[model samples]
Target: MFRNVEIALASLYVTTTGVLIAGIYYVHQILGVEQWGIIAFLSLIMTLVVGGILAKIAITPLREHFHHLERFSKETLHELNLPINTITANVQMLRKSHTDEKSLKRLERIEIAAEMLKERYNELDYMIKKQSEREKIEHFDLREVIEERLVFLRSLYPSVTWDVMIASYVVNCDRIGLGKVIDNLIENGVKYSPKNPIITITLQDNTVSIKDQGIGMDEITLMHIYDRYYQSDSTMAGYGIGLNLVKRYCDRYGIALHISSRINEGTCVKLEFKKKGIVDG
Candidate 1:
């Protein structure tokens, strides 16, 4: 709405100025006097006053509406987090207690549901953080971070087998942003793969590659993979924001990304980070 208003006002200003200039020149020619200068100044002043009034009128409701939405989103997210955290914590405690196999399986399912909600919440949290916070740069070991994420993912998808060959390498990056990139890549590999899938991750010479034996894509589907809300398989569970966000983070950090896939075979994604001048321990 605000963008529309800005464009409209800009067009109005351009059109109005052209007409006023033409009118002033013609009036000056007709009257042959200095009074036309005063007329032109008054006209400009009136136009500015009217434009300012219109802008204020158009913007007030839009401003209020956004404020309301922001407030609602914040409050609702807070409420959602409280229950999710409580359920997750309680479920973990239950896992340590004595329980039958059937009950344990049920609890495991509940935990998976909670974790899935947490992933959705994380996506929302990622977006909110992108808007409100500056990226934090820190030196860290990429191998350690990948290992940590893999631990979490393994619990989520126990049926999938992982082959990791990442070497320790220091990198300067935003931890949260990079974590999201790794999480989304691994999550996609796990989610898209068939039962008992094999996903391989290798890090070498500042390049990290994740390969999965899954239902691969055609060239047409792969072309639009980076597009937001563009999913090759609509029936799969996702908002299609994961790959788009991964691309966004990679671009922001000067990382090079590549993808290779063959239909019914698998998909391989690679990210190469920019090299730092020196490796610091």
Candidate 2:
């Protein structure tokens, strides 16, 4: 589609320039030097008007396509809320009534699944709001958010070992965005690791680090880690958008992000908050 648009645009430019050149030559020969300036001005104005119309016409379809996608995303997210809420509410009621170990375990799994769905919904909503520039920044406890995300992730990946040593540090930023960033880093560590992955997380002095014993990337892979949809290992089951989103959020919030890895050893990611928005508690 983009190639077609490029072709159309190229053709439009060539045709417009050819016409302008021919018009100028004719005016120069027939109208003499005195009137040439006025003719040239008129020709330039005509070219601009024609070019603007052609460009708008060529771009209208692409614009409408994105508009439809955005609208569809909003509507789908709105529809998802009802089912997620229903599942969560019903699970809560069941948990209150059931006391048997087997039944409670089943209920817990259901509750976890529902919570995961809710998290996904929140992630999608956050992305939409972020693209639209509607996300608001506010002060929130960094430790609290990381702990909350870890709780959910631990439930999902029970085999993975978590070593956390987080301090109470408050920072002003998009709370949901920050949560997404943490979730992505931790999840990546889990996803890329072996049978029993060990993830180490620590926070101190407004800086946080997440280190993982995973199949680490080489230097070339690390260089392209932030590229959207680029995956180092094709066997991995992910669309490769995690690190890209993390990079964007960090850059936007003035957070310093550093990632280092050694192949077969592991990967470590660090985020340092700017002093202006950080408050040690």
Candidate 3:
């Protein structure tokens, strides 16, 4: 889309250049006033014709490239679902069958890996489907969703202890989308924190905060944190798309998202929910 805009602007520049040249020639060389009007009209027509042709030539290839990329991404995401589901199901079955401690622990690791893969897949799916499908927005209890996600995540990150202080906050938005945002924030806190780290989660005044005493990022990292596929530390096991997706969801729902951090201190992510209404009446 940006490339197309550049092409259009270039075409306009070409038209202006042509018009300027013709106008200069008419003023300096041509003496007949009647011919001047005729020449100016002819120049305008010629400029439009040339500009239109050049814009078409410049934009067609770029449009085709983006279309091809979109198709490839959709096809790849479609192919991934079958294998991810298979791995997840098999891991669950194995966990149920294995009673031994070491075996169960190994199985748990596999389950966590499978779950992470599934989440990345879902994010990709959301990016593609959200453009076409109308969002299933409705009022849902924020506290309920937060607790539900914590239940699923707690076992996965056994070392990190969560401190949650939530009041009855109701939000009108897509529940699943909001859950993803919450999941990503908590996951990041756990992933970067030290052994048995404390994660503070608070929800009040229509705002949710996730704070971690982990390896906090620098200013440069914070600046590019929301960019797609931009990871601050390449050593960390993340594709760097999670926070970007969170930003998109927040923008769509009028949620104000903010992050504050300093190296070796900590990081705090605050999400202020926009009001549609309150539920705890």
Candidate 4:
């Protein structure tokens, strides 16, 4: 700390001395008392070069400081994932084995929240690490992937209705990442929605959207929907980082992401692709 202060003070002194010397030299030249400004120019330029180098050197530590903070968050979430997975699994087992209907229902809600938290942990890990930028540009069938997960998601809810428009659509993307985006969007719809709510998904051209008639979020939460590290206090447990990573992934691939919502009405997430992707007819 003291060292930085000393360096800063020295830089200030150098700046002041250079400015004073140049001003005096200019005055001397104007009064015909001096014929040489060569030394003054060189000194001024030297001061600039040295100050720039020193300032850059100071920024290195600040960069490392932020890196350390992100790494610490990753480590913390990694530890949290273990207990969360265990708790969710045990809740499932208990639901099947135990006969208490009310308790079992409560456990189911806890399990869902736990699983959501686990997914958020996964997102944090990917976002903090140096992820590959070339992963989402490959060509593949997106509708097939959606169909593959459809049965599982349907069984999990057994109430909310989903209307998928595309029977078989192909797109350019990293299958794993895009699959997660779809899963999270579906999960969000199911989590916040009332029982038997209607969830609609449409894929046309190069765009896909998941719209849910759930208790939608307000304007404030919608604005911070993609915040890196956020938490919601409305009986839902999430690290609030999933959509942020999805937005990041899409943006890197030149995809446009749009979200809209009205309180007590519904929320819509629209993803528009810009690559060699085709939607099912």
Candidate 5:
């Protein structure tokens, strides 16, 4: 589609230039050198007018395409919220009415899944609102967010050993975006680690560190870790955007991000939040 648009624009430009040149030639032939200056000025004005029109024509479809995509995203997110909300409400009702242990456990899993889905929905909603400069920034407990993400991730990776030492730290930022950053870091730790991986999470003094006993990256791989879609191990199953997302959120929120890794040892990621974004309880 983009290629076609480019070709069309290029063709229109060439055609317009040709017509301008031909018109100049015809005017120069019919009139004489005395009128050359006036004709040249007219041609320049005509070229500017034609170029503006052509530019508008070329941009119209692209503008419409982007608008269509934005509408689709908003509509899809709205539709998705309905079903997720339904599942959450039903699960809560079932939990209250059913007293059996097995049913309650199943309901708990469904609730967790629904919460995960809701988090994803919020992430998407954040991105959209962020583009429109409408994302909400509020004070939230950083430790609570981290613990919530750990709960969801632990459910998914039950075999992995988790060691968490977190202190109460409140931060003012886009909560969903920050939550996504935490989720990506922890998920990557779990994904890259060996079976029964030991993941350690520590939070203190407005800084958080996540260390994983996984097949770590070399110096070269570490350099490109934040490059979108650049994976250290292609054999590993991932799109390689996790670190990229982490880096982006940190940069946007004035958070300091650092990663250290060795080939055979493991990887450790640290994030230091900005002082202004932190609030003391």
Candidate 6:
């Protein structure tokens, strides 16, 4: 799509610029006053045509970008599918073989991670068709998920405050999507917040909230919170896919995803969970 636009714009620029210069020369030396007005109008039209050509040229890089991302998405899907199955099956095998306490515990975490990867692969497969029958849902421990992601988030945002409540929120959710949503929220809060500012994460009754006392959002950002590539602040590190995943999980599990923020103050993200309720709920 962008490639076509680029080509069209580039063609327009060449045609318009050529015409405008010729028209001005004709109006100044060859044409009289009456004809000059017509020539000038033609020149103006020529400029617009030239602008279109430039737009086409500018769209070349965009076309390449779109192609790269699309191809990457397809290639990665093929690569990730096999690994997901292998890991999930291996995890199940380990779980059965492990009878000791530590072995059982380690296998449990591996099983959870494997389960998440399976859902992620399924999401990739269902992305285009959006097959409702292949939906991935399960009861997830929010604390475990948060802890798993904390190691990564700490690396991403070292200065921001890190807080996680010592409780379990076994909410009915899609493990992969839920983990991605929460990870995105926490990372967003950490990235946008002022250094050393308090980032609070609290859980109660299956509701988990991540609040940050950092650069707050205004009406515009708040309105399009989950919009793709919406990085109004320029400082935050994401293309807005984070909150989008959050929204996805929210829709999948019938949970509430709320956001409130103010400039120079901070933002609060609330993830409402279904209390052991099924996905159909």
RMSD, each candidate, Å?
4.5, 3.4, 5.3, 6.4, 3.9, 10.7
lDDT of 3 by residue, 155-176 (tens): 6788887788988887888877
TM-scores for all candidates? Answer: 0.79, 0.85, 0.71, 0.60, 0.80, 0.53
C-alpha local distance difference test of each model: 0.81, 0.88, 0.83, 0.73, 0.85, 0.72
lDDT of 2 at 170: 81
Model 5 clashing residue pairs (backbone): none
Off by over 4 Å in 4: 1-45, 92-107, 130-140, 144-159, 174-195, 213-249, 256-269, 278-281
| Model 1 alpha-carbon drift over 4 Å, by segment | 1-53, 92-97, 277-281
Once fitted onto the true fold, the runs of candidate 2 whose alpha carbons sit more than 4 angstroms away are 1-11, 22-26, 34-41, 278-281
Please write out the lDDT profile of model 1 over residues 128-178, one tens digit for every residue: 667765556778889888998887788888888889899877788777778
* Order of the predicted models by lDDT, top scorer first: 2, 5, 3, 1, 4, 6
The candidates, ranked best first by TM-score, are 2, 5, 1, 3, 4, 6
lDDT leader: 2
The alpha-carbon lDDT assigned to residue 1 of candidate 3 equals 67
Clashing pairs in 1: none
Task: Indicate the residue-level lDDT of 265 in model 3.
Answer: 82
Q: Model 6 over residues 129-197: C-alpha lDDT tens digits? A: 233355566666778888877765664454666776747766665666666677678767777866676
Off by over 4 Å in 3: 1-42, 95-97, 130-139, 174-177, 215-252, 260-265, 276-281
Select the stronger candidate by lDDT from 5 and 6. Answer: 5
**TM-score of candidate 6 to 2 decimals:** 0.53
